[model samples]
Target: MTTDRVNGIARAWWKEAVAYQIYPRSFMDGNGDGIGDLAGITARLDHLSDLGVDVIWLSPHYDSPDRDNGYDIRDYRAVSEKFGSMEEFDALLAGLHARGMKLLVDLVVNHTSDQHAWFAESRASRDAQKRDWYIWADPAPGGGPPNDWPSFFSTPAWSWDEATGQYYLHLFAPEQPDLNWENPAVRGAVWDLMRFWLDKGVDGFRMDVIPFISKTPGFPPIPEGGTPQKHYAEGPHLHDYLREMRTEVLSQYDVMTVGEGNGLDQAQMRRMVDARRGELDMIFQFDVVEFDRGEGGWPRDWTLPEFKAIFARQAASMDAHGWTTVYLANHDTTRPVSRYGDDAPGWRVPSAKALMTLLLTQVGTPFLYQGDEIGMTNFPFTAIAQFDDIAVRNAWARAQKAGTADEAQFLARLNRTSRDHTRTPMQWDGGPGAGFTSGQPWLVINPNAEAVNVAADRADPKGIYDWTRAMIALRHAEPALVYGGYRDLAPNHPALFAYAREIGEGGLCVVLNMAREPQRFALPRAAEPVMASGADLEGREIRLDGWGACICRWS
Candidate 1:
């Protein structure tokens, strides 16, 4: 592995590499089980390797109940039988490594499934040996939850245990009980499980809700109208826990670590990922991805300047130190084309390419969700019954129980912001099941799979997938795109987003037309066009034809 030292800071492969996330359950299915498995992933490794993503972030496939689509892990060291066996998982890992790609398994240490051995023993009785492994508290004076904390699934964060006669804290679904990080034994167990994978030669981790592992000292009650996340996010001992994790497990290997920094501001983000801090290599900040999120799972409108400013601020935050992820969508988000790009008939291809161009040209490491490269759009969910995401189901149930649910309006929200939009099966071909499976898919395939499958996309040289492949190649070929300073040329432009990435005397200028109307941008300096999609240039003046993008090289 080659390491670049710029400004006395070490930049490793992850800094310059593009990462692709594989939501295993929805990616591909082998053995015709209607569920994707390790074997499925191994069989499809070529798709990712050909796409040129150096890292593959595989979501949880551990022994899980599938309650939260595999986020509720039942065992730390075992693969879910539904997904595959341990041997099959080993094959998948070897496949990734063999393809010159590293695997970052989802590290969901903040909580474990209620069925996990530790949680089972913890909930068996108050005097169980593992009783302290999870957060357990007696009912409050009012006979309710221990505190006013709320679950991420839109319910109280506590669930009463009949056998133990106590309420256990669960930041997500009740099936997922948050572990007690204050306990030394729990920390030791976590470190051991991490090493279990490291010893097996897996790359690193995409830590899920890592900051939420630590809690406020006293578990204070929230003030009126205050959000629950504000009280529990980035708790007092977060850095201590992270540093201990680094010392005990992470620093031993040359692996990458990216934490989900959901509620963290830019400064807090820097504090978590700054190399000097030794906490993490990078963190995913939601400032860019959550712009469309609104109250009660509804979608909100956002302006281009607002969107551009959020990204610029994120880039600025990492300018001096630390690293951040550049992504438009993930398993937890709506499809990027539907959310950020023009996914309509003629504009879909260009807009998808343009968005990817923006991602690859950014200074931070870029991450691509499974089907985003093919310009996948949101699914038209007509009924709530079709939704499989726990977050969406819980939110809808809560609204219905409160008698405030408008079926039509809520369905619209589900269509716009629900995670199911991105959880659909990958479109490998236009055939039955989109070539994902011979049997029925676990989830509904997008209706436009026939028109947007990879088979069709790869056939067209200018299609989104090929454009993404070429962009990844460009990013790898140009060191400036990864290590350069970012400067926005049209920060206030309504339809144009132009930025220059400069390092030393060589640099690349990226121009993106973010609208359907054609736009013209004046380059800050003379440069020759290197790549373009739906764009043309004449004498340092670029004319972007409706959702077009262009990359210019300068030396």
Candidate 2:
């Protein structure tokens, strides 16, 4: 009975699947070397399987200098020694497959670590055959970077290469040199690397900042004060390159591909993932989650009405058969409980469950970030010295240099909103180092691990971890939740975000209170309760506690 309905959307295995994002360095340290590794992950596959996620979206574990915590890739085909060796990676993959889970490796082709062989050869000499593999240009007049365009750190996006007497482009950190996609050599190299992984029996690829691969030819400069992203994000050859990729590599395998697209709107999303476009399977856009960012991308006011609008537009985009990757947190974002849900002493677990309910029941692939199931909260960072993320440090320094933000206030915000909030070592138990490791951790564990952890939560039959398992079970059983038409049931409600999902004769209504105060919401009709986050309703007139959410079906 379950397979019959699920098979409707299960035409593509990924469509009916739920993915969990794992940041290896923080998940578990198998060797007790103070960092999570492939061996560690292989040892912990039971935790993921027990939680009931279908796919594991493992972040980059490739060889690197850890400049951006694996985002800067030094070798595409080799697994980082910090994580484990090739044999250990294969063992981890085998473990996942044996447990009925798929693996989606991170694809960081936008740039390569400066130490990568390709970048090293390219930077060697202007006459070298590999010199054109990267974007290089002569220094601008007055001896400065090629453009005034900003890096993620707000500095120029180019770095000078004294050896070559030119400046090379690095849209991100200087250590991550952008690959010249226009160079067929570079494109061929990417395809070879992708095939190397695919031939190894891995399931899919999560392309990192993939949209940034193409840039305006000739590397034109942006206006002194204008937004540079618009000029560099989309290029004339992006779709063509994606089509080439499909024809060259991805088409030969039964695998999924999700690109981390930046500055993409509805049309661009459709162009990239529409089946006929022959580009990608789906994309993870930032519009919904980024609506609450304040200055310098800190957390800000997320009004209910605005959030509803953002969600409505996002859902509307999917009406065209274009798929999306639904998630509230990942390696780069803050934890959902700390970002959107109330994390007050007694409310954190319930609030996280509510968020899981909302995310899992949506009509798309769901990505569960590590530790989110047990309601992980932010770290207690009170100073800049506590941060290890390059993005946070850059932002803090920029703010400090500008004299616009107070040190204490910025530190307070970092504690609440930085990516390090989610990067803290996973709390497997209440033991030392949160049971992630007996050795020192790469990053400090969240001090609340004793109270909010998987071991403790698993012991409590009704805990959030159990609730998440039930949610995944329900989603897997219902076709309506997987491929249904979404209708906003209470669009204008200030505090209640209500919606209905329907497919054929089956349907479910989901209602969530987006505030700290309890809310009373009226049902459209008499309905049978399916599941809830905080509290159950007494009748058709349902009352929801703070940060509560529920799903129901019409009788």
Candidate 3:
């Protein structure tokens, strides 16, 4: 029943499936070593199965220096000792498959840890065999970095190598040296490593910062007052390289491939997911998430019309054959309830349920981050030392050095928008360390865990967990919800977000109150209620409480 084709779209399992991401270091602690491991994940398989998600996009667990929370890869094939051994990883993979769930391993080939053997050899000598494996350039005229390019971490992208007499480009932290995708050997290495995982039976790959793989020739300088990321994103050889990957690796397996598209536009993103182009299955564009983000990573207020326009524009970009992804939170983004829905004391539960309704009913492959089902809110971070994300730490250091660091102001922004909020331990029960670890957790657990743990949520009949589970069930059963044509029913409504999804003759209508005030929305026609968070119907108008969401069928 879950495999039926709808709206004449291609019958791809990935299209119909729902994916959940697991950030390993915070998911669960198996060895009681204060960190999450594969064994703990295997033990928690039943929790995911019960949630009705079809795919699991596991975050990076490969061996690393923990510089960027496993994004810096030391070894592509070896599972990190902190996470577990190779045997435990295999067991965890088996556990997911045994429960009818697929695995999407994080592929962070945009860069590798400086400790990686290839980088070591590359940095050894100018004439080394692997010297070209990474992007390296001579120093500028005055003997500084090759160019003025800035990293995503807010540092210089070029790091000087004293011993090698040159600079290597790192679009991220210096520890993560960018791989030269232009080099055939590097591309071959990536393909081989992918095959290594595929041969192990992993279902797919969630490519990390994949669009940054190609860089413009000549190492051009970024324009002053211009976006730094724009200079390197969607380079000349991006599609050509993706085509090569499709032919060399992805074509051989029945696996899903989604790239992290950080700096791409709508047209560029559309090209990546177009099946006929044979580049990738889909790419994650950040328009919806970044829409509310202001300059320098600050939080900003956004209007409902603007938000609707973003989704409508994104949905319109995909044709009947093309597909996109729907997600509000991931390892890099803030919590959905905190960002999109109200997370206040009294409104948290209803708002979380409403956001889940929006996520699951959307026309794309939906991905839920860890703790999203239980309505986990952001951590009340008071100091910079509590942050585990390198980006935050780097930004804070830069602020302090520039004499612009205001303690209260920075904390406010950090509490509102830091990625560390999503990296906290998954709350299993109302116990110490949120029952995620018997010993001390690597990061402090959120204090609200006692009230927001999975055990507590699942125990309540009207909790967020049940609402999310029911929504997932409905999406899995209804073909229209999976591949339906989307229409913004109230495009100009200030506070009411109403849209209809149609597939052939049958479809569903979704109405959401995005503000704190109650909203009365008029339906285009009469409808039968399917499910709702907190909504009431009076005659031709549906009244929704603050952050209320409802789904219905055409009468």
What RMSD, rounded to one decimal, does every model reach? 1.3, 2.3, 1.5
lDDT of 2 by residue, 1-555 (tens): 133333244347888899999999999899988999989899999999998998998999999999999999888888899998999999999999999999999998889999999888998899988999999998777878776767875557899898989998888999998999999988998999999999999999998888788888666777665455556666889999999999999989989899876877777877898876789989887886678877756677767788777767777786444688788898887888887888888888778888888889876788899999999988878677888999877776777788885878888777666888889999999889888998989998888998888899999987999999999999998878878878898888888889888876569989988787999888878888998876577778778888888889967
Error of 3 at 337 (Å): 1.0
lDDT of 3 by residue, 1-555 (tens): 244456877778998899999999999999999999999999999999999999999999899998999999999999999999999999998999999999999999999999999999999999999999999999898889888888989799999999989999999999999999999999999999999999999999999988889999998877777687667888999999999999999999999999877888878888888989999898787888888888877889888899888878877888866788999999887888888888898899988988899899887889999999999999988888898899988998999999999988989998988889899999999988888999989998998998999999999999999999999999998888878999999888998888989986679999999888988888888888888778976666888989888888887
Q: Counting only residues 3 or more apart in sequence or on different chains, how many pairs clash (N, Cα, C under 3 Å) in candidate 3? A: 0
Clashing pairs in 3: none
lDDT of each: 0.88, 0.85, 0.90
Residue 63: error of model 3 in Å? 0.7
Candidate 1 RMSD to the correct structure: 1.3
Off by over 4 Å in 1: 1-4
Task: Identify the runs in model 3 with alpha carbons over 4 angstroms from their true place.
Answer: 1-5
Model 3: how far residue 17 lies from native, Å: 0.3
> What's the CA RMSD of model 3 in angstroms?
1.5
Ranking by lDDT: 3, 1, 2
